[model samples]
Target: MKTEAEIKVAIETYGDMIRRICFLHLKQYADVEDIFQNVFFKYATKREAFDSAEHEKAWLIRVTINACHDFLGSWFKKKAVLTEDFSQFQIDPHSDQGHLLDIVMTLSPKYRDIIYLYYYEGYKIVEIAALLKKNENTIHTRLRRAKQELKEKLGGDYFD
Candidate 1:
């Protein structure tokens, strides 16, 4: 069992990253919340000590991704095909940033994940490749293709 201080530190350090990963993978807020809770629960219960802070963050990311996959595969999730209305929550009415996020969310999970980790989470290609356990070249190819797809979808040189 992990100590309270350790659990608290983990939560404070990686909470946003975990939530962002969950949100990117899941469509519904309810499901995201469930997976988010489950990820922390798993962190608190797991016994392995991380070799470094980077290792700990990577482990959390992996666990969060796995939990999202598990949630998607659950029988209840399979039976329901619900989607959330994004209009209910808006931080800024005039910001076009939300539109970009909407476009990214339209991507398939593979591309969406790579985009989120690379662009949003500030991970380099090498880092993302290592985190996702894919070849560095594969990450490069996916990112290139994903950018093209996004460009086509958004039109008029959306990415710089």
Candidate 2:
């Protein structure tokens, strides 16, 4: 297991990114918090050393994605009907950024992940493909389709 200091450093470095990924996938503040803590806990217990900071970040992202998927797939999640409080998610719907986020949230998870990794995270197509474990061509196609869908929904030159 990693030392406390190491775990603290990791949390400090990637906390926001992990939380965003959780929120993107789960769309519940409670789930986001759960997965955020779980990710760090896994990181702390992980025995292998990463090759570099980038590798560490990539590992964390993968873990967060997998954890979210697992959570979503759980029977408990399927059965639970807890009230969701969006206020904790903190997107101001009146703002342009919030409007874009709302639109993004309406997208299918596949497209949403591609868009978030490509545009919001500033990852290149190749990088996104690697991160998502998808073919480069698939990533390219999804990006194109996602942009088109967003454009249609926004009815503006938002992507450009």
Candidate 3:
């Protein structure tokens, strides 16, 4: 177990990163906050002793991703579709970042999630695989498909 001070430092240091992970996964403000809380809740409950800062950060990210997966599963079962695949968006530059997020949202959710982690969150394929609990090859293939999908949605300028 870490000292209280050490744990506090971890929370302070990693909290924003966890929040960003949730935001990238869910995109909705409320859902992102819920997943953010779930990340800390899992930390409080798991009771596993971390070997290092890197371990703690990875564990937090893993839990955040799992929580988002759970959220998506329950969400689809319970609710009507909240928005269309694309075009319902207001083109808010911060959220959509011009047309990129719009194009990303058009992707099937599987590819969208991987692309969000890879491009928006700056996670490498190996790191994204670990965070999303997917095989590296799966991540690679999804990334390729995601780019192709975006290109189709955004026209040839997607690469330019």
Best by lDDT: 2
- Reference-based TM-score of each model: 0.89, 0.95, 0.71
Lowest summed lDDT window (length 10), candidate 2: 83-92
Off by over 4 Å in 3: 1-8, 75-91, 94-98, 157-160
How many clashes does the backbone of model 1 have? 0
Given candidate 1, what's the lDDT at residue 37?
87
Ranking of all predicted structures according to TM-score, beginning with the best and ending with the worst: 2, 1, 3
lDDT of each: 0.85, 0.90, 0.72
Winner on lDDT between 1 and 3 is 1
Candidate closer to the true structure by lDDT (higher is better), 1 or 2:
2
Native RMSD of candidate 3 (Å): 4.7
The residue-by-residue lDDT of candidate 2 on 53-84, one tens digit each, is 99899899889999999999999999999875
Over 4 Å off, model 1: 81-94
Tens-place lDDT per residue, model 3, 92-157, is 755547567556666776786687677765779998888777899999998987888788786675
- Full-model lDDT, candidate 2: 0.90
- Tell me how many residue pairs clash in candidate 3: 0
For model 3, name the residue pairs that clash: none
What is candidate 1's local distance difference test score?
0.85
